[model samples]
Target: MKTVLITGATGFVGSHVLEAFMAQADPMLRVIAACRDRRKLLPGFAGEVREGDLRDADYRKIMVEGVDVLCNAVAWSSLWGHVADSRHLFLEPNLALIDAARAAGVRRFVNTSTTSAAAPEHSSDPQSEGIPRPLWPHLCNVVKIEAALRTAASADFQVINLRLGIFAGRRYALGVLPILVPRLKTHLVPWVAGGRTSLPIIDGRDIGAAFVCAVAAQGLADYEGFNIVGPEVPRVRDVITYLHDDYGLPKPHFSVPFAVAYPFAWLMEKLDPIVPWEPLVTRSIVHLMEEVGVDNAKAERLLGYRPAYAWRAAIHAQMQEMAVRQTRAMSMAMPIV
Candidate 1:
């Protein structure tokens, strides 16, 4: 049996990966978790939990020992703000984790990443060099993480980076949908570029399945990357229209080109100190509106990844969860910093 250690087991990506690993019910696989709080793990999860913070050197060192594969689903996200904190809280720690995994004899490392990491013009290139955005520091750090993995990969230590599209589904609160849907309710959100760009949203279940494929797939290179998106990439207009018609959410009342939207967003960010709440819009959100012409062809050929859920179903699942939870609007930064 090949031992797989899943970091961030209590998180959205990590939880789904754990579920996929367990649902397989294969005698050839042995799964465990590394999370700070074992109590937060999914119900019916009877696997071993190596509980501790990744920032701790000892914990990072101990977690990957004797593991055949390390699925590093742990992620720190912020759509805008918190530039300085990212290096210490996210980038440095993830880099340390990668170092630990390599030193502990782990043969394979699977990393979590996003599609927007690349420049909008070069997004179609699955493994293109990531272009940094000053408006979104955490996103810029994601690019740095990818570069680190590429440098870390070797003949023995194989690294697989999953460049996932926008996240949707249950057990998560911070994403485009949770932020956008609430903003739409205010009836102030406008269509950037007339809502014509593609939104490559993917279901949490599909995200899990892709990881399963990467973990088991053979004949992969030492450093591998794939763009894993939904089966169908929906237009922004179609998604907002569906919400307006079915869920009673409001659609964008007007349209603005990218040139106008970026400046407006910058002004909102400038008003941060005086405003009682977070900015209604920001440049990072506008960045998400850019056309990311990504597809699933590469993932299908290499990892045997096939996304099963549609955009509507994924949105519906998140909307339902937000109703029960999400007491307040999720900010672009975690811990409000």
Candidate 2:
């Protein structure tokens, strides 16, 4: 049987991926869950649970042992500052895992990434290197991780990078809805570029399916990158309008171009140190709002991916979760230790 290890199998992305893999019920495959806290994992998750920290070199090595495929969904994300943490906490361990997995003779390595990692000039291509913004250091590290993995791909070792879209759905943690919705209630957020830019929101369930397809895909080369998105891409206006009409969340009172928005976001980041609370907005958030011309054509053709979830349905699902769990505005950073 082919052993497959899923790191952070309890997280937003990891949970969905884990669920999809179990749904397949392939007799030839053995699913192994690798996480720091197995207790947080979803109920009815009947898999070989390997509990340990990804940071531990010993644990990383042990997890990949005898594993033919390793899907790395672990992430330490921060919307705003914390450059040092972004590297040490998030980037470094992921790099170490790639090396460890490759050394352990893992046949396939799947990674979680965002479409924003692609350069604006080459927005359509998920494999393209993105422009690194100085304000958002985490994004720079994301690009670096991609480069490192791409370099590791050889005839013997395969790497699949799934450039996922804005996340929304079950186990929804920090994301567009969780972050932006509360701020919208403050009546502070404005429609950047008249809310025209496409919000490439993809549900967590579809994200899981994408990873499953990537794992099972055939005729794939040593290194493959695909833009994984929802069934349809919606505009910022369309999403916000629905939130206002359906969910009764306040909409942006005014509009600003990307020019004004970027600087405003920068100023907010600069003020974060003096302010007792998190910044109302950040450059990274603004960066995400910018046009990313991502589509599922490449993924569909290559991975046989067909996204079924729509944007509105995903947003509603997220709002429902946020209503119960989010008692306060979400912090800028996600630190898992």
**Candidate 1 structure quality by residue, lDDT tens digits, 1-337:** 8999998887888998998888987788889998888998888888788998888899988889899999988877788788777777789999999899988999999999988988597787777767888788888899999999999899899999998888999887478998898899898999999999999999998999999999999999999888989999999998999899989998899999999999999999999999899999999999998998999998899899999999899999988998889877887865511
- State in Å the error of residue 289, model 2: 0.7
- Per-model TM against the reference: 0.97, 0.98
Q: lDDT (CA) for every model shown?
A: 0.89, 0.89
Q: Mind giving the per-residue lDDT tens digits that candidate 2 earns over 53-127?
A: 888999988889999989999978988888889988889999999999989999999999998887456768877
Candidate 2: residue pairs that collide? none
Supply the global lDDT for candidate 2: 0.89
Report the lDDT of model 1 for residue 278. Answer: 92
- Give the true-structure RMSD of model 1: 1.4
